[model samples]
Target chain A: MDNQRNERKNLRRQRRIELGTQKRSPLGWTILWLIMVVFTIWTMFPIFWAVITSFKHTGDAFNPTFIPWVQFKPTLQGWHFVFITAGERTLRSLKNSILIASCSSALVLLLGAFAGYSLGRFVFRGWKNKDIAVWILSNRMFPPVAVVIPYFLFMRTLRLLDNPLAIIMAHTVLNLPLGVWLMMDFFRDLPRDLEDAAFIDGCSHLGAFFRIALPLAAPGLVAVYVLSFIFSWNEFIFVLVLGFHKATTIPILIAGALTSKGLEFWKVASISLIGIIPVVILTTFVSKFLVRGLTFGALKE
Target chain B: MKYAYRKHVIKWFFLLPCLAYLIVMAIFPLTWSLRLSFTKWLATIMENPEWTGITNFRDILFKDPRFWSALWFTVRFVFLTVVIQLGIGLGLAHLLHNNFRGRNFFRVLFLIPMACPPIAVAFLWKMMLHPDIGIINTALQTIGLAKVKWTTSVVVAPFTIVMVDVWEWTPFMFLVLFAAFQALPVEIYDAAAVDGASNFQVFRKITFPLVAPIIVTIVLIRIIDAFKLFELIFGITSAGPANATEALSFYVYLTGIKWMNLGKGSAMSWIFLLIVLGISLILLSRLRKKI
Candidate 1:
């Protein structure tokens, strides 16, 4: 009976000690949480503001205070401005951006996959292949501006300025290199035995690549596709200079709106929201794939 | 014999489209620009009759003050933005390294700026820094500080550009560095703690040394990126209250598009490219070794 009572007393003492430790340390946790909360608010507020401001009337934009509740008098005037008021210019820009981004990404993927497969599977003629890959990367090192003058002159001479094709072609120039580089890395990680097996089964080289390698590289393809698409979508310099009025993209439009002098905050905010919506949707859906894609071969053994 | 020839032709065909695109879009333009840099021509009305070989390059290098100033400005902006961005990024990554509630949410939130188009962020920040109605000024006034013209003056305009850049990009650094930090083995940290080292000491001695390579890599990348900074500054200040923010890239825009001085612009652009290429080559060689 004495031992049981002493054991119970010790248990109570230990429980109290654990509770004390837990209680005492929450101060540090609270401070850390507070800092994080503040940062979260700071990071998210501008984006939130842009979204909210998009649904607001132009007059309501200049108001000094932020209202927590959505105004019942909320208007789609800003959205109207973006879609309707800007004439067919906005629609044209959107269509052009879509065309350029999609086509460029598709081309990049097809070519990149082929190039990546070759680099991965075949031991080419010499160190020449590696040098070729390096040279391709070096092309990206040249600033877009360096080539802009000549591109402008070339496009103008060819009557291709203000055309979506110009931007598409330019975007491909940059995107292809990136795609090849990334896809090569992806292809490098793939197992060789699978290809060997396909070859042993009497499949031709292309057939084996298609059957064994291509399917396995789907995630890498998706990653490169998404990256190329986003890059082409967000690309400003080539689009801005080459496709001024005819091939205006959302970036160029936003730039034009912002720099147009008057404090058209509502319009700017609305256009910005439109510009970001697709990317936000994309991020939420494929964020997992993005993590894997972006960190390709980084943590691999 | 015909079958072998056909196979060789097919192989070349496979490589043809990409090679053609590169030649037309990249190689052709590069060479054209190099040649045009030596000839005086107006892009708007293309009647170039004279070759001024090396004059354009000479003028840009020796005679032009704007070119030198623009180069210096670009270098300065790149240096400042890269350093501050990396510092804040590393600090934030460190702060968020330990596990906590809502860690995933915080990570997602921090990545928002990077995912958003830079053009939009530039406009949003421009609005937020408006002289009279901006929240920044309002906050300053509320705190009993005098409201100064943020973007209206020469001195403050460049500073504002840098600040906006830091705000938009520090998160990028945070994301990259956070991944690097998370990749570090926890046992190393545990060993350091068991040796009675303080958190700061462990971070300084062990954590930093391990992550230094990544930090250097990020800094070099950011420096290269900063040299190409265009849209944000173009949207915000248009290279200035008084050319205070006229970076090398912006100068390329102003010269080529705005003034239509194709020869001078092409020459200036080539020079900028050469500088960036030089830096990138050094970094790329280092990166190849590290990777």
Candidate 2:
């Protein structure tokens, strides 16, 4: 009799579990669908507007109609204006931006990796190293404007104005402190056993670092590169102030377009679209690294 | 002894690149600006600067109306943007925190505005806010509301600038705060619910306090960033029909870069620098304590 009762209880419990699961699955799915719909609209609206406007003839863009309902023939004239007629200037700007952003990111990573490893591995005699790290991070606290004039004049004296190398130099100064702080955290999180084992097996410290540790920290290094690159690429103020006709960047081009009297709106929109393409593409593929980099040192293992 | 000396040399070698960049790019320029602030010089024609200690400061503080107005505008902009951005950001973060389909896509979408150039976003909004043929006016007119001049009216211009800033930057606050929210443990939330707390009560008693530090950090960062607001306002209105949106940063540009008054511009730059540094120090101490 007890066994039969137990079997009945088990059957009821199974039915309850089945019903709970059935109820939750549909509810979860509904919630998910709602979220996706709202989020897609919110995020895609402005970008859609920008791209569509870029395609529209000048008059239609000013009269602003919602996408798929606007009455106008789409034309590639804006793209032609931005890329072909202004192609030489735009291409020069793009080249300069690419060079500055790439070189600065590379330099920051190399320096940051070396210093990060040192901080992660060594302990010095004084409390000075900790203080130094703090000081380096604190440099980010200084407003960019405070140092702009000085940098301007210094560059002027050195005849580095309108030079891509000058912008790269300026960016490295701004990004290096943050890079070191972040890389230090990444390096510290890595286990010392690999290095220690390598050291024991007749490997030099440098060899252990290159052969064992550096490979292990590849993801973190990539994170640093993506972030530093993005920051440099998107940097506007220094570029605007420092770059002239010789080394104008995409941001400078966009700013100039907006400021010019009676400038073609469609052309400005087209350039804006083009300016964001690289950033959007980079962020889409490497968002994981970007997010990780932003949250660096925030989460302690 | 030899090995110890060699290790020291290697350590310094690793530090050389960064130190070199810092000294040339950061230290030298900063010192030059500080020294230039106390001297009077014209960039256009004069090579030698005449010593004018405290004169530039006196002129700016006592004589320049634009300087004071710009200072007031910056303070107001920073305060309003920080509060509104943080409030909206927190709300959106909370709303989106639960397990939902398309959360990942939503997260990416929310970050889109931040990733795009600020100047581009500003220009887009300017197109939308245009009075005669703009969509915003058209929608209002369709709904039987009178058309409002957004950029031309001085009173409306600063407000429009604020709105543009909010539209472009609220997403940034949302992204950062969402990350903070995700870092929160679920067990504590469950415990709150078990104690007969409503969802709102659970959020108030548990989630809000847990996220306060991050919220403060975000606010502080926004304060510093807002003070640097230039591109958007510059693009949309160029400090407006009546200098309504003439922020301190823009003012510095006008005085120094446009007007060629290096002495006054240097003074203004120094003042802004000091203010930024002071606020930054406060934030640094707060962050340090939290960590």
Candidate 3:
């Protein structure tokens, strides 16, 4: 034991001597700081511009000034347009977006939890787990455009076009695959010993899953829920093709403003700012989960 | 026997709804689309589609110049966006890889663009790219440069689409690669340093090789996702400036829904699917080896 400790200490010294502290020079640090500042400006500039655009009055909206408060007087006209005159449409779409995103996320989590439990916990003779997992993920590979045609025809046939129900079902189809993959990763990371302990305590498999695994995977559930909600809220193609008047979303409205004559910059910017509020809030809350969710747990930070 | 039956029932009961949903939503629609591609369907509620056997594909392949142009446009768009996004994303990742004050704050700020909805981002760019009042043109003019048309000119519209995509998704690449950089074993760097390797040499030999697979994966994923480019064009250009910026997905949208040419649309979509799937299979196979 003494010899082992001495050898470990020697190895540490050797490592330190070889690596030479790995410190950056002041000049290097200054250059890095400059790069970072430039990047920060690049990332924030467009969003800032949108905010500035949203605040401008109709005349000032077309003003070619980059500075917001200095070059032009800011006004509440765009906000008023978003909230009051076009208020009903905005409120209706916002309601539809919220209802659809939440309900579909609930459905996805409920259904996906079951599927994930099965895949993560059990191994069958004929069903190779990896292949099954890959197959489930492959469902997400088909571009929404590829499938929108049939969905359109089917919705038309069912007379469910422009209905929020249709949008919810479509959103569920889009997010359920993602939900399964995410929950599968969560469950796989959890040790089976806990479930075994529950089984010994007279909990059946389903009870063990619900009582033991589900409670423990609450963070995973939040990650899944937030992601699915954001995805459903941000969906554009299905809403465009499927909805008409009754179920139009904020994204559709924003896109529509582009086609109308005389680019209503302030109104479009205001509506867009309103549109991204829910997503922005949710993403800020789950920013830590963003990378894991994006890569499907391929690279965990 | 009863216990075994119950076990089997519970297991499948959990799995069946998801399978059934995919079958109805994914498989059924795809098969229907394939069948629709082979017929001449004008999308009348009452009229039956006439079976027209491969003519749609033949036309799209040989006769349609727009189809080929759109396909080439999409390829160029994907290639340019992938290159630019990777470059900017890597630069940002490298900058943030070191310890710095407010690093976490900047990292979160970088992710904001991606977190915003794609439609909103596109519209935001539209607001910025307005030839008359857009901050971009305004900035250009302020700098004593000629203000260029961003999304309205035929020559520049495609590049504008690529720019919007790069703005929205470069963060995605940065986040992925940043995580990869964080996970890299510092001992390797230390050992290389001990060998008196120069900083550029260490980066070129040690860092680049370690990050290459991730770079590949990120690029492949970006290519696959870029093929589904629709919202940006739909929101920003609407496939306009004379169809200069029409991606394959936007073309699919135009042919099928806007034109109401269901048969031709279906054909275009199937061909699109085949190409996307072909690339995806290659990605998947390569991914299998790496992971």
Which digits, one per residue and each the tens of the lDDT, describe model 1 over residues A1-301?
Answer: 9998786556544533433322446776677677767767877888887876677666777655566354435678888988998858788878887899999999888877777665555544655556556656666767777788888888998899998888888988887777777777788889889877875687766676688888999988987888778778877888878987778898888887864568878888988877787776666655544433332222221
Candidate 3 lDDT over A1-301, as tens digits, reads 9998786556545544565433667887788778777777877888887888888888887666667668988889889988899889989988988898899999889888888877777764586666666667677767899888999998999999999888988998888877887788788889999988887787776888789999988998998899889888889999999998999987887777665577778888888887777788888888887766665444465
Quality class of the docking in candidate 2, CAPRI style: acceptable
lDDT of each: 0.75, 0.75, 0.82
| Candidate 2, number of clashes | 1
The ten-residue window of minimal lDDT in model 2 chain A covers A292-301
Worst 10 residues of 2 chain B by lDDT: B95-104
Off by over 4 Å in 2: A1-43, A68-70, A125-127, A259-263, A289-301, B1-9, B287-291
Q: Which pairs of residues collide in candidate 2?
A: A32-B101
Angstrom error of the Cα, residue B31, model 1: value is: 1.6
Candidate 3 segments whose C-alpha is farther than 4 A from its true place: A1-23, A64-71, B1-8, B44-46, B286-291
- Candidate 2 local lDDT, A141-173, one digit each (tens): 666766677777778888999998888888888
Off by over 4 Å in 1: A1-24, A68-73, A259-261, A288-301, B1-20
Query: How far out, in Å, is residue B105 in model 1?
Result: 2.8
RMSD to true structure for each model, in Å: 6.7, 5.9, 3.5
Better of 1 and 3 by DockQ: 3
Every model's DockQ: 0.40, 0.38, 0.57
Q: Point to the candidate with the largest lDDT.
A: 3
In Å, residue A24's CA in model 1 sits off its true spot by 9.1
